[model samples]
Target: MGFQEFLGNERIVTALRGALRTKRVPHALLFTGARGVGKFTLARMFAQAANCERLPDDFCGECATCQRISQLADPQTLLEQGLAERGESADAATVERVPLILQSHPDVWALVPDPVRLKSPVARPMLRVGQLRAVQRAAYFQPMGRRRVFILDGAETMRWDVANVFLKILEEPPGSATLILTAPSPYALLPTIVSRCLQFHFAPLPQAAVEKILKEKTDRKPTEIKLAAQLAEGSPGLAIEMDVEAAAQRRRSALRILERAAQGHGFAQLFSDTSALAKDRDSSFEHQIGVFYGLLTDLLELTSKVKEPVLRNAPLAKELESLAKSVDSAWVLRAIAGFDELYVGARRNLNRQLGLDALAASLAPAPSRASVTHS
Candidate 1:
């Protein structure tokens, strides 16, 4: 797919397209963004475009090369071709000298993740050291095509030992090869690895950008698109993954807890509910955080756009107004700080329920003042 097919991210599209046009594709690139934000998808398209014969900013998707790439048949053939050489006695020594992976030719071999160490981890799949080794092994051989591209999705999942494994290769990668890695965030990656590659940061998509693509790509209803776009917070990929029914359930749950946080004095109930909520893998702790962020974004939007007293959440908006009467900007800042810390912990494999419970407790005012009032 051409970058033009990608909605939003005009800056990224422009830069990458320009690079392709100039034939100045970087050997290594780091794309950092949230999962389901189209990072992996984009990286694949880039790999295809680099190998494509049609020279332009956009891909002529009708070409033989384009068709093969679209079908992901090119790399497989390359792998198969390399394998034939190694087994054939025609040139056994040269073939044997080639890396085992290259012995079959360059193909996408996602690194095996380290055995799961954390008890409750958000990352189900990770990239392993074995995968990084292949990058080096593949480097000795020349590309069958004009350019060879290796797409590594979930680069941040590289365990600590394997994390810096790519640094040396990235620093001086083969001219004919390109390594494209995508990750939710680069902060967790070793700085040495990060600094060596050309970095591309993907910002969350706007609501309109997401909706347009949904309309273009799928047969979703208008309302479904609206709600999904609203909930995805700018990630079109995740928006597509979103189940309308599940999203509605999340809203219901969030509203329920939000009301509890607003009016209920039983701190124990809030803690218990959130604690239980965090343990739910089906409804991921991250998804719940998205729900919370969505609510806050809605409230902020409402407060700024509307003339009427905050009407969205009667209880919570009312509490917000009351707090606004006395609370300085610092209180809101502190709440964000608490939530941010929880978000950090959640990413670092902290217990979701504990992180959220602590966040709710921190966001809630001390019990004496925040206690439920009787009419």
Candidate 2:
């Protein structure tokens, strides 16, 4: 993708273009932002622009060098040649194929964690020292072209030893090479690693921008696009993944829970509502809690207004209106507060069921006292 096709982050784009125009591109650059916000895409364009044989400023996308870099063909060609040299058969060659190459430049070396180390599973996968060493070895080599670029996609995943191994190369990068690192945030990386690079902060796209990307990239319906754009918190990637039906279902479930509580049904119905959130060790439990929190926030917003409020869960407008009519803002506020506790507790790794029970208890209306007659 050229800079022309890339959307949003105008300031970052301008700065990068300025670097290219001046022939003062940094040897090491860090692109940090939320996932799916085009950091990796922009990095690829920058690399292609830097090494383009014909035009370095605007990047002639048709050149052999640009095509190879954009396709990440160097490593693939190297692997295929090595296989051919060993006289591997077709069947074996199929098995030996690299799984993760979406694309890269021939002059652009892409580094990621070795899958063997990642097979065991972890919250964060470790980028092994071997990968860094390979990069280090390649660092000293003369480029096959005018400029060489190394792209580390999940730079934050580098283990302590792995990060340490690359520190020297990062500080004083070798011949005609530019290194680019992409991560969710610079804070996720080591201070030493962060300090060595020229950092570009990628901001989340605005709702309209996210919606535009969704419209262009997917066949999602208008309503789904609208709801997802509102719910995505400015991440186009998240917006594309959001399912409108599922979110509406959660909204309905939340309204049902509120209705049961207001009817003085106590913990039974609300407990059932949160049955999916009983796990202390699972992240899904946290997500379920968040869904409930979104519901309460919707209720609070709906009830505060005499009419319907603008809703991400717009499909649940009728149910929201009904709930708003029945419950006062004070009651809805209390329910919202209850969910706040559950959300906080879930994050802190407190007992999920206990938190849900406490939340339900707080929201359940006080028991009615029978009148005592004096004879």
Candidate 3:
């Protein structure tokens, strides 16, 4: 996709376009922002624009070069060309897609870590030294295009050794190569790495942009779209990815728990809901903890008067307002702290029902020692 498809970040787009127009693109760039803010998407677009034969400001989406960069032009021909460039003989079926199959484009290479597994004790995938070494080896080659672009998605996932290797490349990069890195924040990487690259900070999209994307991209109800956009915290990718119905149901269940906890009533429904959530193996317990935290968030937002008029749980605005009136900010703050402790405890595979009960109990005026047990 071209830069036209990217919403928000017009300033960044303009600057990058100017650089391209001047034929002065930097050798290394770091696109830093929150998750799903289109850092990787923009990097792909930049690669397309740098290599495209017929575009100045934007890549013609249908051009042979643009389509190849996008991994959609001609898989078999691209595979053959990539194999020939690398001096390898491989069948087309053996080839993977872009980012994974870095050889798909003669002037493009991608380094992306595997999916992070937060639930398990296993570590998140990282950009290893070997991967960096491969890129280093490929750097000296003459590119088929006038410029070569190496896109590194999740640049923060690199370990110290890997990062050092990447630093060396950035220090003396190939004259024809442009390196692009995407991360949640450059602070996660070595200062040396951050120092070497030109930084572009990508902010979250506005609610209007997110709503527009949700409307254009999905068939979710308008109410659901609005709520998802609010919950997305300005990330349009998150807005579209949200399971609206599931989130609504989760919020309702969390509200019930809050009601029971505040009133010091029996937590029968709380236990029942938590048990069901635990049974849904596809849904993480962390999500349930987040829902629990959302109740306190709603209370604090509504009472503080500083938050936007649109609440995450607007459907339960009356209930939240009623709850807000019953307690002062001190109690809400303590309850929020208690839920935060429970949320941290969730990472340790704590008993889901027990954690919910403790969270519910903590909402009372006098929290028991059990409330802090998981903390």
TM-score, each model?
A: 0.75, 0.63, 0.67
Instruction: Give the per-residue lDDT digits (tens) of candidate 3, residues 212-263.
Output: 9899989988888888887676778767777877767777777776776666
Candidates 1 and 3, the one with greater lDDT? 3
Please identify which of the two predictions, 2 or 3, would achieve the higher TM-score against the true structure: 3
lDDT of 2 by residue, 1-375 (tens): 467877889888888889888878788999998666777778878878888888767677788878877665234454444335434333322322432222354567776543332223333334556567667777777877666777788787776565888898987778588888988777668899999999989887777898899999889888888887776656686667676666556556666777877666645556776665474232345446555655666777877773646554456667767766777789878877777677556545577777877776666666621221223
Residue range 1-375, candidate 1, lDDT tens digits: 466677777788788878888989888888998767777667767766766668566666677666666654233454455446445342323422443332122333322232222233333546645557767777656776667777776677676676666777886788888888777677757888888778998988877898997888779999888877776778888888788777767666775565565553567777777766776667756567666665554455454544664332333455445534443444445555766787778667877766776666666656644553433
Cα lDDT, all candidates? 0.64, 0.68, 0.72
Worst 10 residues of 2 by lDDT: 366-375
Off by over 4 Å in 3: 72-99, 115-123, 219-224, 249-304, 307-375
Best-to-worst lDDT order = 3, 2, 1
List pairs with backbone clashes in candidate 2: 68-106, 69-104, 69-105, 69-106, 71-104, 72-104
TM-score of 3: 0.67
lDDT of model number 3: 0.72
